[model samples]
Target: MEDIGYGLLDRAMIHQITERWRHGGIGIIVLQLRHVNAASLEAVQLWESQQTRLFWRYRMENDYFFFLNRMKSDRQMKLILDSAITSLKKGLQAAAAESSVDERAKPPFTIGTASASPSGLGRSAETMIYHALRDATLSMLRLRMKEDETELPFGSGQAGARSEWSSSVGIGILAKAIPTFDLHAQVSSLAKLFESNTHVQGAVIVNQGRPVGLVMKEKMHQMLAGQFGLPLYWNRSVEKIMDDDSLVVDASIPVEQVAQLAMARDISRLYDVVTITRNGKLLGAASIRSILECITNLRTEEARTANPLTGLPGNAAIQREMKQRIESRQPFAVIYADLDYFKWYNDCFGFAQGDALIRYTAAVLQDVTGILGGRGDFIGHIGGDDFIILTGSSAEDADKLCRNMIWRFDGGIKSFYNGEDVAHVVDRSGNRIEQNGVSVSLSLVYCDGSEDITTEHISQAAARLKKQAKQLNGSVHVMGEVFEKHLGEGRV
Candidate 1:
């Protein structure tokens, strides 16, 4: 109402509220014109009575309210205003939901931003949102394509004829096939394998099948120098001399993660190979050159399978894993890990810091999962701070893992705070704000063979559990038999 008291319609209040709403991208503005002159009030009444132009006026005794000129009739003005407000509220809600979904879909290493142009292409907001969403959809398609491409044969396709190379190994190859060196074995013993088998140039040292370091001829020689060489080389164990600086890849690592590691090395400083493993058990090693080649091939074969920012497998991989689990009828748990207050965190910190935070989160997930047990376990980057882990374990195990992950990330959150006071402060526009604390919400679903589970079902279950967890101030929500029972009774 424009006819409110003079003090109530102060310019400062209007400016403050208007600025706040504008910065938040909210369009509605409110103003009050108090104590209108008689002539002006008469003009307003005349304008209202005509109702021919695109303007609507309402009166409360001496006070009058004028809506935008586009709205002609009083009824039309009310309807349009109501509709616009409703639409604006819906838009805000959708934006918030989309933000949450994006955070949950992204890999731990990929950062999310409000900026339209992710690659500095100068794209508009609409174009950027479309492309980002499109890229994510394409990534899913690529994952499906990869599944179709890597068709495993029911049986071995080819058999090699017995030759000198094949036969010479046949005599004792069976014995050598079994791993003999325990953690206590001498470094020389492991090195001897390379010497005994000429085909093996250098062996990457693995601990419980997880690549901890590499033991090359050069490193071995260095360890064998001087008077200490005799005792160390002759008796010292592999555990003592094993290099501990080897980089490792988990089974569910996206090709992008591997590519980034490879790209970090110069030609001279290049690694010979990258080792792949699951839960500390070595799967195999792909030579750096071979990995680079695979990446190139994958890009051509299915450009959309990989996340551009984090390079982790997309939703396609997640769905494929779910389908495989279904087909195999195995027991497995699905974990949906989401960072809490990530949007606020990103807003508080710069984009660079946000990127660093995402990378750090990914590293934490890798480190924790690398030690897990069981086969067919996978950890995939979905796209920001959301990650998916499929494991053949009970819900309890998943809960523990999720808790550990949260504890590990707490350090980074503290670092981000950097000793800032935990006090609410007003921004330039006088809006109250507080620094975000360390927190994550986890939704875990455990499905065994007996249950008929689908990806969509799992997703719904996880979503419900996530909501429950978030309600507890961002804690782990275990969704299994207990959750099912409660949900079945409509208790949730």
Candidate 2:
């Protein structure tokens, strides 16, 4: 009923509890139990141990609705609060009859006796479990929202591709909360931690829950193997040997930025684990190996979906970009570009020259938009000579962008012609044919986001404007009800 702990949204803690849900593990149910239900520590522990088998069994059968369901609610997702409480009620009644112990027993299981014989769950444990699941579910929901909001604008179309881009791979996606030790913990204890967990590369040293230093396995082992290494440091505190200058980054930062900071470390500590924090408290750590691997996966996905001809994003990425912008309800404009007489040019000069023109048109769009467009502008190739531009620029700037695109396109198109004049080109039969070259026609559609605008609406508007622009001469741009403009030989 009270506000859930904000720290539970930390990626490591969320993964830890969700991992418990996935595997029915009971060792680390709640990292900060006090943040959930502080009044009864014993009840929290009892619920964690007693409820895993039963709860996970229920989860397995209903995993479709429990784990695989996507958020259908609005931007804030207000429904998750009620959905979490509802799921808790269902999980509480699961496997009631199969247990050996009777639920109606007069004396409920006490904290001391609950662990030894967890067959009968008490009211305290039930209450604790309810709050824990509710809070955990809420935390997971918020984490998903954060990932979606910060995802790269031009990511791939895969189901979970939002978190896979190097430009938007937040540290939370890769960081895992490995074992953490107090600042005063002896070096020998850290040595044991590494021995016990061979997969762990380092231990985060915390002072009152805040990360202060990092103790890496390779460096510690190297120190201990040195002259008088064991005697000099084995019994001393870990702080004496820990890397205090280790890189610490907030969890919301992109992994690409974090990778830069990680490599900037001294060569001796280049491979040290990077600690991730939330609100200045230790959340988890990401190894250089994990960061690099995440970056590689992101880049691979980008390259897979990019337009081969011009290296711009393709249809799927374009659709996704438009969809996100529309859903965001932000005022933005769409510029749909189509080349005029492209097929005739291809027929006259062959496909090779036509392809070169397509690439050149893409370059012109990029340069014009980069100079005149607002921040976060997007450009995509919709296959062939069709391109799309989405920008948050003002109407005046949008007009300028269209005019500049036409100017640059007309100027560079002469190079593709056979002679100094762009009106004539050599045909396949070695005969000269009259051709005016290719000119761009831009269909500009502006949406204030006040109305319910869909991608279909924008596409339809662009198609309608394209028909109108083709009726005129030279390169031109047309917008609904605002203005009709043309450049070069013909003016409208």
Candidate 3:
């Protein structure tokens, strides 16, 4: 216990501890001590109780003082911790490449010491140690992955049904199948490959057809430009210098999720190439720069086609959605919602109130859809006071959806108008007008997969049904026939 306290205060001891931790020595001490006997519960209980009391006592007294009585000031301590982290990263690099040269020749890949230094400002000594231990543990994990590459056979990730998200915009759209090299490929050959192809940013490293790491052109050049340079690593395998911690993702993953994962990496690895795989086999690689660019373009295109008033997808996206569904030959419903008496309401309440009503109608549609909608259901805004819901739900669910929207819209529309204006409003000249307030007319057209249909067909059917709904009383939903049979008919 005393030796442990002393070790915390000594700079040399701290470095040694980090080194040992990286090599997997002291990391499993607690695990080794946690051998509990389920057969002897009483003995286990007594052992845990004693350990708990000792931990609290040590924390309250010795742990507190050991941090307080630092051998170095806070700034100096941070410097030491940062130095220790840099040493571990460079030392590992050096040890991996040192075989080609004498002990006097420094490792060629130790050029980016500053990049590996963790920012330790405003952090306590304890916090710095925690970070140090975390890096060591992660390094150990990467080392284990490399070790397993030889022993374990390559297989697709866990067996199960692929997630629905896997069907989204794939990361493969941005991936480029750049050069790939085996783990034991010579560093000289890798350098020549990069030299011959100036555009190649990195190469994926594989072990027996399984992607294990990535070697970046910039990082490799920085490594080989050191004093010993090519001599220190020219003959060594690329695995000695490849980054085993590079992000590896399946190709079918959504680009948005991949962007998030890429941006969340450590600063040193933030710009690393993202390795993409398909069924656990190497597919291609995408640069962080390309991933971020793709996300930006997608957002820009989405914003350009989205409705500004309700922020729902606009006519362009709506047309695309309908076209795709039609192409897939899936049974779907196009429920067109148009506001009745909206022109009179806009004339009375002004444009701002009309916009509010439009937004409110959008909210109601979204709420109803959330309750009754299934996967792949789409809600879009056609224009002011006009919305469209494209759903793959059955005709019965479409009827229920339209009914729910009418009930919610009628209930909420009352709050937007005065008490007198909700029912009947009298003009200044004493002429009374029967004002039914604003209500929604939903026109549903269901396709039964029997006849050939297009977006134009669905739009025309919904437009005709919408006119029939408008001819009726307050808040009515009318359904059109397909194949000489009525799918659903409702009125409220």
Candidate 4:
């Protein structure tokens, strides 16, 4: 029998080698055969028999041993397998190239474009044919190769899967990691409250039992500078000078958007800290230094409360805001705005384009909700294609703002939809696709501070109203007296 390479041995061959070693005593014969061979016929015969038996035995033991050992030490096995496969592949490639070169040396000639010489044309064509055949053979071999299901050492898929699973498991880790401030305590001025504590330059602000704004050093100085004639600078309430317009961020908002907002406003000198809140309650103040240190950390935490891709606050943040409104019992409207068919938009354009759409939508939200300028009431990114505008402003003001959002979004319709009458069909792939255009459906749920309404009731009512608005073909749905009647009836 020929000396079969290690690659060719099957399980049956391995078993046979093991059995022969046990019964024929080949191990003892090979160990003792060194002194008996001196070119004599009998000595040569014995030596040859021992060598053959040893070769099979080595294959059997190595195959089983390597397999069993690899189970416990997968990393080592992977290294070994990778090296072996690489070497085998290179050797096979070299062999194929040599075979091609030999075949090309005897090829038929054909007239061609670069036929300046007889040998050149034939050699070039033969080389091209050889390469083509080689590539096809390699591709087919790769397709036929079987992957071992048992081997999945480590890779992006595993890492991604682990990350997603960990994220799902550690959903509320951020809330636990950071300390939440008492809305009432946060409302106090750091300048006065910590007048003796020199290290405390500024303090976070809160309203309605939720974090809403900030009282920074600049604002403090501005207020004190005016009161130079009076000795009441320290005695004055920080609330009096608190910047209502100070950039406030929800814990759930993406840090990237927060960073972008801060950079755009140049908040470092104006207000160096980004105050985090939940439902208008103060969570903590994250400085520019702190934010930049671990952008990914803030991003991950924010993703839980915001959209993973768009960096917008998700339904959780919206729910928190709604709850705060209900608790305050303020007369405010919940304007639920949803982008029309954002999924198709995302699919039609690439994710990068979808990202642009989201950013544009955010800009629209920021522009329209500027009414809440410095006050706590304003707009929030409700993930994907949704946004919520909460304000103590009048219904007409809210309506005007929603209309402005629609108009501004519509103005960019040509760029987004490729001039195909937004509603008309255009080829997305092979099929004709019609986009619903950039339209917003608004639902307003009003609450009187005097009413005994709950956030849950308001949300449910808003959802119903949103459904109604979606029905009117790009119209706003006002929950009106029906929502108020429910509150009056004490059905909350």
Q: On residues 49-152, what C-alpha lDDT tens digit does candidate 3 reach at each position? A: 43211111111110111111112222343353344435434443444443433423222221111111223456533344454433443343333223322222
> Which residue pairs of candidate 2 clash?
none
Q: List, residue by residue over 42-116, the lDDT tens digit for candidate 2.
A: 433343343322222111111111211112232221233244334443333332333344544221111000011
Q: Give the per-residue lDDT of model 1 (tens digit) for 400-483.
A: 677677667765666766577544433345455563454666677778778776788888878777777755543344455413
Worst 10 residues of 2 by lDDT: 108-117
TM-score of each: 0.37, 0.51, 0.52, 0.37
lDDT digits (tens) for residues 1-492 of candidate 4: 445323112344435433432332111111111111222224323433433222432211101111111222224433433443344344433443444233232111110011011123444422332232233322322222111111222211211111111111111123222223233442234544546665454565555556554665544554565536136645455455565666776665645456556655531232256666666666567665344324434334434454544444466655665666666655677667776556666766777877787777776666666643224554566666777777776656655666666677676655866555556333334444443554556666666667777766776787776666654544333445324432211100
**Each model's total of backbone clashes:** 7, 0, 0, 7
* Residue 11 error, candidate 3, Å: 18
Candidate ranking (lDDT, best to worst) = 3, 2, 1, 4
RMSD of each: 31.0, 20.1, 18.5, 27.9
Best by TM-score: 3
Candidate 3 error regions (>4 Å) = 1-173, 182-188, 191-199, 204-254, 257-284, 327-332, 370-377, 392-400, 424-435, 446-452, 479-485
Q: Write down the lDDT of every candidate, Cα atoms only.
A: 0.49, 0.62, 0.62, 0.45
Candidate 3 Cα deviation (angstroms), residue 219 = 8.4
